[model samples]
Target: MAAVDAAADLLLTAARLPDRDGLVDIAVVGDRIASNGPASVAARGAIDLGGRLVTPGLVESHIHLDKALLSDRVSTTAGTLEEAIRVTAQAKRSFTVDDVRGRARRVLDMAVRNGTTAVRSHVEVDPGVGLTGLEALLPVREEYAPALDLQLCAFAQEGIIRAPGTEGLLRRALQMGADLIGGCPYTDSDPIGHIRTVFALATAFGVDADFHVDFSDEPLHMHVREIADQTVRLGWQGRVVVGHVTELAAIPPFEQDTVVAELAAAGVAVVCLPATDLYLMGRGDDINIRRGLAPIRRLLAAGVPVALASNNIRNPFTPVGTADLALLTFLVAVAAHMGSPADLRALVDTITVHPARMLRLPDYGLVPGCRADLVVWECARAEDIPATLPARTLVLKRGRVTVEAEHRVVERWR
Candidate 1:
């Protein structure tokens, strides 16, 4: 064990780390974890966690903040992806800066209260809405910096080639302090051209690229192959992410292996949005509806980085959400048939380790010398988090207490 500090800014004692037995003391000096061992150290303040599970804060890799919380205003008869896009586009014409900021603040509050410390939100950038979403969300990033790290992605929800002036608008957004760029190839008239254009902007700006690709019940459009090839060609390895490749589930196992291999080799990461995929897909099927999810197990087994995200909250795309990542883990456990002890624990990583790596967050983890961003769960075991959605007891960002809650229950007729 490393030598303990004489004094710490804050000391978390008797904390149970995930995947490890017994308890240890974590000493935080300033904004970083100074030590993590059986330390007999002094501190200005301390909390005894009572052997509760302690893990790194959750990460939300792919979500739409501008389009969220619209289910109440807009009604959808057909839950297809096309209709969701059409209705959302129509509604965007009436959005105001205050309205977008207000809605985004609500979701961000929910995420932080649920133990999320980092988020990558895709804000629309196109001819219709222009940069209103980006403008609205830019201030929220700073407002929540004390409790959350928000990455604003300038997203081309409409097809870049078909939407006319969208490419220029995306460029302007990046200049306006957007962290990264995102593309939706399935909406484009020319999917390949859309991929090339997004990559062009990414390379020009020296920013990462995220795409919403292959979101369908059938294997009609598998543009991820072109994305993987371009990722390698542009030397953007480990800097590209693709979300909602539900079509991978429809292809044969052998064929899926080929594409998964390409993605892994190119260092491309995948984000699976179980809420939106399950809601929008299989709308045309009458019997034995498909799950309409990416090959999560296959991708994970192939050494590919995979994350499960909420994608939308109470919007036309998903129709319902609370911005709780743990609920998504529970959904994946049953939907993906990942019910084993190890698989359940791995699901926790989708929201923590995998997404943090996807976002390339520096100094993120539970080790010494990492950022002191931690979450103490009400549950004692890591696997119990997915099996039973436990409440968070404490959430710390940069060694400072951000959110604190207590969970209690009483049996009336015991």
Candidate 2:
């Protein structure tokens, strides 16, 4: 371990339950949490959280940095997924390493300010330009590792296994120190085949798999059955993740329950990107509207591990968003109809422990010896977060203040 400046540390104090009561103090040493309780620990500095809600630093399980940082470029007027893809494809050529790095850094700052301490951003690695994008973002990942845990998904936006030379690209990305493999299978021509091949390669390479299961509103686009069968056959039940199975919203209630059970038994986690889905799915004509969100309620009821994600940033599907996992939680609670107190706690896991599980994070929560990544929201109550979505007053990444709460003190001019 590298030596840290002992003089540049802090002691945070409050008086309440760390999760809800809005009064909890956390102590930070260097890059990990030292203590979190009612103790007046001596330190170089102390921050008074003043009865605000203390929470684990946010974690964005799904995000597209390549798509998100492209906000400043040309805009997509059609507001459809296909059009957005086309626009992004046209703009990819102009994105140099410097340009991508700069924009991604800016977006990271936004996320940091918004209390997101960990992010799993999907950087496109397909279409030849993906490697270039990854090269630019790798340093950013390392730069923030001490303060924030940043995981890059060597994402093949196209079909992974079916796309030409996809395996080679995946191999190259892993060689470049990428942490995981990503894919968009259901959208591909051979969804099942693509998923199987991707999963196979992931297992062989000893990497984690996070793939898009289905993004469409159509009932036929779902892949839960195929994924279950594949997991059992390949013996990769606990190692795979499928995001955005929005077709669950269309399936009958009984069918939804059955599928949820199957997914749980398969040991697969379902990631629901509520904000992105709210922007993309279920568009219709006169007097008929469809909700394109995944069946988060039923999935949770069946005890399937479900995580919430911020899938896109300033892309066609979701043109405006910071990597605030809390925002995803807020929107998901409303869309999924999970409003009870118990349900809210479960939903909070979507942004905290659930995503940590998917990312295979070694340690999480405010436990002893865990990394000191914590956040203090300005709100007085935890459940009130969904309605107000309060600003994060303080953000500590690995026991360091990556973002300090702003103060607006008024001094008398007398």
Candidate 3:
């Protein structure tokens, strides 16, 4: 909380803001940007960025920190989703507070170093793990308060209706500062009931809803449309987010359009977990090929807000992740084929601008009235950002420098 009290009069000189008023300097005062124009106006302190691309601090809209970095601890011969679930559930029983805290800390450090300023992490909230995940993460959230704003979602990865007391556990998690109610309807016996329970808890606690819906290659059990309808009926528009709706890719084109339009109408946000879905789905289909990812272009075309993120970091669900969102953005370009120059602009929005809107982050962006959560990358143009991962980057949170990495090349032979 002291992050707000220590704000100083800082100025970022010669930084570029894309699609706005070209290259300009930005000024910050007390955690909020006061102005963004000429640097000669002066401040208490100033750092000359020298034409670096300055973007809003990255938003990690979907991530699971609880099961992060556990691939080494748990062995899996088959990289199927069921194996992932079983191994992770079995591992949770032995999760001491220190075990969870240490692994989460690594993920947090990776995210911060990669320019992540805000993150929404899903913590398991079933009877098997109880509130241990939530309990362990709360302090870590406070520990990284200055560098990263961590939001915890009480995820019922096991089930809700079938698990009996799972709903109560989610409620308890929310009462303990969990920001949203999370659900995986595919894991539940009564998927509809599971969705309703998540919405019910979110409604009761006046929080938001995020569900991991229809994460399969088969499109028969899709529920995104129903969830969109429920959003409208419950008046939870603009407050609900659904992650990994991969079945949207498998649905008929017309139905996909309908669902996209419905989601847009209800003001629901969609998150695509490319790594996990592309890895887990289509395991049973050997004769046929399939693309396991949500339709990012179609959703954006329909005006339904969407974001891409590093969903899992080195876990059973996804064994390879660095908590670096630039990799996610790069994957979006390669996997979704949005690599055109015009499309590249949209790709930048997927990580910086769109996610800020999806997560409703306050004081975000490089605007005068927004927060000073910004990333100064060693790049000239924003379109060239995704070609590689973050090289030398400087990340700021609430007007304070949290990460600063630099690389220099010298000609010694000459």
Candidate 4:
């Protein structure tokens, strides 16, 4: 291998990129990737990946950190979305700053260990929880800055209009350092009004808007159309995201196509929460239960950026989670019927490139000049990521190694 002119801070040798064939060397200068080629580069440190697959670090497009890991404290027999919200609300009544920080920290640790380099977490910002969630997460964000880029979305899990003073609280949260604003339209008395207020805040603050919209087994509240209209009307294209649109699956194919077209035209990205959607939806059916999920393949075919995300972890909403984006990809590959090599590779994108685009992350990728946030998978092929759920051999954030794992198997009988 030929040597580059300038020395690198770190050099990764014999690594396989997802799109490129054969092994290459990645040279890192400061926090950016200086070059990637089949050449040796002098560096202060080096790692021989032995042909392991390297990809841009996974991104969690949408998550709830404030209300995560509450299944033990809250009991839910009905296993419905409403019940989860109600029980979590009751739990929030007893929440303190330390409590929120402790739970959120645990989840963050899990995420980083799983090779997630960027996250967009939605913290509930209603009258019930006040600003406790925001206050706790602000410091956690700073603490995890070296390993993960955490974007805090001031979310209204409860109704915005029905729960008075929520709008003001959201404002204060944004003023204090929230990166974005979010809303739950279906949970409000005036769902459209809630969307309007959320957009208003987003535009006023020059931030993005993420909504938990149309999460049901039926097409009861397809507020996504209104959201798309406002996105186009307010010129917020490419700045809006809608999650858990399982209602799109319940509607007719033609109706779904129409809404999907609108979403594509309006540049609104969609996030499919397979864990929560599959768990909470189709609870009424005795037999032939539906697979409650958004039209992920259709959305992707129509050129809309679709992401698979972990909406909740170990709570009434999901009941179980590992904060692993690869697990979500595996769930969707079966639940959404995406098994082709192309589809499987695309599913990998949902956790890496697609969500990064949705989050509007700057300088993100494995190419030269991009940030050096990368993950080396044990497998050599991208398609095997979802099929095998490969272990992360090494996780890097901004040229700094954050997490490293080793797996060994010894056959005593042999």
Candidate 1 at 277: error in angstroms? 0.8
Where is the poorest 10-residue window by lDDT in model 1? 1-10
lDDT of 1 at 344: 97
Q: Model 3 residue 156 lDDT?
A: 96
Q: How high is the lDDT of residue 398 in model 4?
A: 94
Candidate 3: pairs in clash: 363-371
lDDT of 1 at 273: 97
Flag the better candidate by lDDT, 2 or 4.
4
- Tens-place lDDT per residue, model 4, 1-414, is 345688999999999999989999999899999989887678999999999999999999998999899988999999999998889899999989999899999999999999999999999998878999999999999999999999999999898999999999999999999999999999999999999999999999999999999988888999999999999999999999999999999988998999999999999999999999999999998999988999999999999999999999999999999899999999999998999999999999999999999999999998888999999999999999999999998999999999999999999999
lDDT at position 83, candidate 1? 92
Better of 1 and 2 by lDDT: 1
> All models: lDDT?
0.94, 0.75, 0.85, 0.94
User: At residue 171, what lDDT does model 3 achieve?
Assistant: 86
> What is the per-residue lDDT of model 2 for residues 64-137, given as tens digits with 9 covering 90 to 100?
77656566666776666677767777788777888888878877888888888888888888765758878999
Cα deviation of 95 in candidate 1 (Å)? 0.7
Number of the predicted model whose lDDT against the real structure is largest: 4
Residue 352 alpha-carbon offset, candidate 2, angstroms: 1.5
Question: How far off is model 3, as Cα RMSD?
Answer: 3.4
Any runs in candidate 2 off by more than 4 Å, and if so which? 1-9, 18-25, 407-414
lDDT value, residue 16 of candidate 2? 42
Candidate 2 residue-wise lDDT at 293: 83
Off by over 4 Å in 3: 1-8, 409-414
